[model samples]
Target chain A: MEEEAETESITLQDSAAGGRIDGKWGYIWGAYSVTWVLLVGYTLSLVLRGRLLRRSSGVER
Target chain B: MKLPFAWEHLIGVIALLLFCYGQVFGLFMVPPDAHMGDVARILFVHVPSAWNAFFVFTIAFVCALGYLISGRKGFDHALEAALEVGILLTILLLMTGSIFAKPTWDVWWKWEPRLTSSAIMLMTYVGVVVLRSVVQDNERRAVWSSAATILASVTLPLTYFSVQIWRSIHQIQTSPADIDAPLRMAWRINALAVLLLATWFLARRWRIAARRWELGDAPPLPEPLQPEEV
Candidate 1:
């Protein structure tokens, strides 16, 4: 009986986690993720530009 | 004669302090929106970024005009500083707006009037930069760029009011007459954030310009750039 209860509890926890994950409005997740990706990409571009500028200036010198 | 002063570091320090203070105030002190819950917190970043983008463009417009009228290197330097800062701030504005839109509007991207107009404005400045690269003569580049900047400035008001003039997916940026207290506080924090970012970018870009000039690679502000030899 104890083993059965333990299994039942585990199943219930798994279902609860699944519900939380699936129940969320999917569009919100897409919006947040896309924004994060774009912002990071832009930051990387800025860094690369700075590095290139530095390299080219060094070459000129 | 007294030497020309550059207070780049001093301005940067002040801007950094403001950003820190704005962040703290935004995340902690501002009350959450009852309708949108804690997700509305993103406004603290988004609204400020939009403001800075507009403000920087205005500075670029004015500086471009000054450069054309005075034919001075200082004005050109100011215009370049404003352009670099404006582009970065415009990018920040778009990123923040899209991020904030998710919880509020339920979409990552929308064909909203304000959003479309702002994107076009940014692209126009980018076109100006490309045009400068294609032209070999410095004087011609400056003259053409100044014209572009002037045209861009004239469109600023229309872009700002586009939403009001036509129906859009977005609402008016800010309306104190309608907003509740919690939302108002959030908007104030956003305003502070915008000011902080503007100061920071302006100072940093100015320092970068100064270093470029010191390195002797930057185009002379007063002398028009001559055509390059093959």
Candidate 2:
């Protein structure tokens, strides 16, 4: 089992070492970009929601 | 053009700073992985989101129980807040997982146990939200939503353990100690930042719930630490 696992990891390393996987920067960029945009958008929405709530309720904290 | 940052908002500012630092470090300072190269960096955010989503959902589960037991509006508000933030993180987690998967797993999605369980988790919380919206009566809404939240939360542990139970293709839960030095540092920093960020979001959401209650949508919260029956 350990030998099989080691062999699999070696194959993974070979794939990563080769230029075949070099272009995976797209996936990395996509993941991080989505994270930032969604988080920022959510935060903005919360701020907007808070502003509206304060305006409608007339009580600011 | 900005309001003064209050003491309560300090955690959020700090969280944002830490997030910036963590992301930069993860993206540039860390070495590429031997197995997945730079693509492994996605785990810096994806892992944190996944863990924190579970943490926030666990909070909601506790709040649900608190509401069911005490009939306190505060608990109800907290439950609502936690669920909102939890759902947000879950979306972030799943979406990033997809983005990461396409390259590594060679598919945007698979009906793997982990992914399937996460879908169940998301829909259950959404159902709780729908339950809240349809019930007009405050008491009924609170009780019904609280009940639904508790039931929905059962899926939390299921999703959390899905990888382990089913031997999923999804990565198993890992401890920082088990990781290499640089990767562990990035992971730890990002995880803390995400926790603080989620806390800030939950606080803001809870405030919104309170303002909503004050606007006569639901009953007002009882005195702090004095959770009266709803």
Candidate 3:
């Protein structure tokens, strides 16, 4: 009986997650991921550029 | 690890923490809109990016005026940093706006006044940078770019009021009554986070410009094509 109850609970949890499966979640996830990825990527580029400039110019400060 | 410290890095860390808080709150805690549902959550980022883009451009405009008046490199460096950051934020605004539009508007892009004016505003600043690259003299580059920035800034206002001035499919600004208190809080938190991030960006970029000028390592210009001997 406990095994049957566990299976039922698992099924219920899957249905609760159905919102993510809908197409709308893809848009939401894509927007958020892209925003962060681009922002972080630009930050990294600035860091790299600064280092490159420092090294190339031989300014070891 | 004893990391060598800079105050700007501290600002960055704080901004990062706030960003995570705001992102989680908007993504998970906030309730979905009645009509737009989960898609409305995107405005938490998009609206802030738009506001901050306008903010930086305003600073850039003021810096341009300062440089013209004072003939100071300080103003010029600030102007350069602001333009680069304003470009980044505007790009973010447009990209996220398009992302939000795909689900809600059923199109990745639309030719509405708000969207069209925004693209022009972005191109205007980018053009200043491109023009700066072409001019060989440092003083000429600074003066011309400042003049260009001052003139181009008019587009910023045009972009801001495009929806109100003309018939646009894009929705105008929403009032407090339009959303719940929690939604307002999420938006404000994200706005602050983005503002700090932009400040850090401006400071870092300004330092780089100053360093380049100090090192006499400004970017090399292409030599004008030599006339072939007849």
Candidate 4:
């Protein structure tokens, strides 16, 4: 019981000092992953659409 | 024969390199925020996306005005491209902002002034795009869409200033003094990277629009039925 109380106090102190919720790295990584996925996917779609349009129109760069 | 180089290609390469560098610097080198900790890294992407959305919308606004004044098809095409790219970036901004808010604000969404105004601005432009698709006449579509684009752009400034104009939980725009040096550096680099990438996308989108304008929107007609079959 004494050791449990000590650990709880340390956790409270850490939270107070940092002003951060512990174990929020998942949110951080999730945000970054979603961002990259959207960016890459959108870019690919743009490129493929452009290519298809060029082919259909018989336009050459 | 290929010239072996183009300005757009060069910009794409440079933007890619700068983006990689900025992401590396931001994700690995910059220290976490005192309050938000690692979650603050989301700002590197979120802020740049917001800025690019604003930048593209501004371009669209100018193009719309130009089309109105000169009646130029080029301006209309440019407006179309910018509106598309701007909407895409705005969607990205909202998604990233929501993701950041989840941990920081303990909510996935909010109807605060800034957030609400951004959603309105996004939907307004989206409506403009949809308006264009449903209108069949080229000249009529151009005129109507340009008008809508200009009217929708009024919301851009509102969205930018929403945090200041209303009581809100969202943080106000930060000044240079408020940011740490390394984080500011990362932010600036990422901002430029997004700007360049946006330029590339705008150019490509514009080309596609111009090509479509030239080719016309009519579907290819089916070959006449065979005489024997008829």
The top-ranked prediction according to DockQ is: 2
Write the residue-wise lDDT of candidate 4 on A14-39 in tens digits. Answer: 43353665557787788778878887
Separate clash counts for every candidate: 2, 0, 0, 0
Candidates in order: C-alpha RMSD to true structure: 12.3, 7.4, 11.1, 7.3
lDDT of 2 by residue, A1-61 (tens): 8975675556454434443355578888889999999999999999988887776655333
Tens-place lDDT per residue, model 1, B124-195, is: 888777775676555666688888889878667877898777645565545687677756766676576456
Candidate 3: stretches off by over 4 Å = A1-23, A59-61, B1-4, B217-230
Off by over 4 Å in 1: A1-61, B1-6, B177-186, B210-230
Pairs that clash in candidate 1 = B73-B221, B138-B225
Tens digits of per-residue lDDT for model 2, B98-125: 9887887778998999999998999899
B1-230: candidate 4 lDDT, tens digit per residue: 66586568788889989999988888899988766778889899999999999999999999999999999999998998999989988988999899888877778898989999999999999999999999877788899999999899999999999987884677668788978999899899999998998888888888888877776764323245699989
By DockQ, rank the candidates, best first.
2, 4, 3, 1
lDDT (C-alpha, whole model) for all candidates:
0.64, 0.85, 0.84, 0.85
Q: Which stretches in model 4 have alpha-carbon errors above 4 Å?
A: A1-18, A59-61, B1-5, B220-230
C-alpha TM-scores of all predictions: 0.70, 0.87, 0.85, 0.87
DockQ (CA atoms), all models: 0.04, 0.42, 0.15, 0.23
- Judge candidate 3 at residue B84 and give its lDDT: 91
Provide the lDDT at B167 for model 3: 48
| List of chain B TM-scores, one per candidate | 0.81, 0.90, 0.91, 0.93
CAPRI-style quality class for the chain A–B interface of candidate 4: acceptable
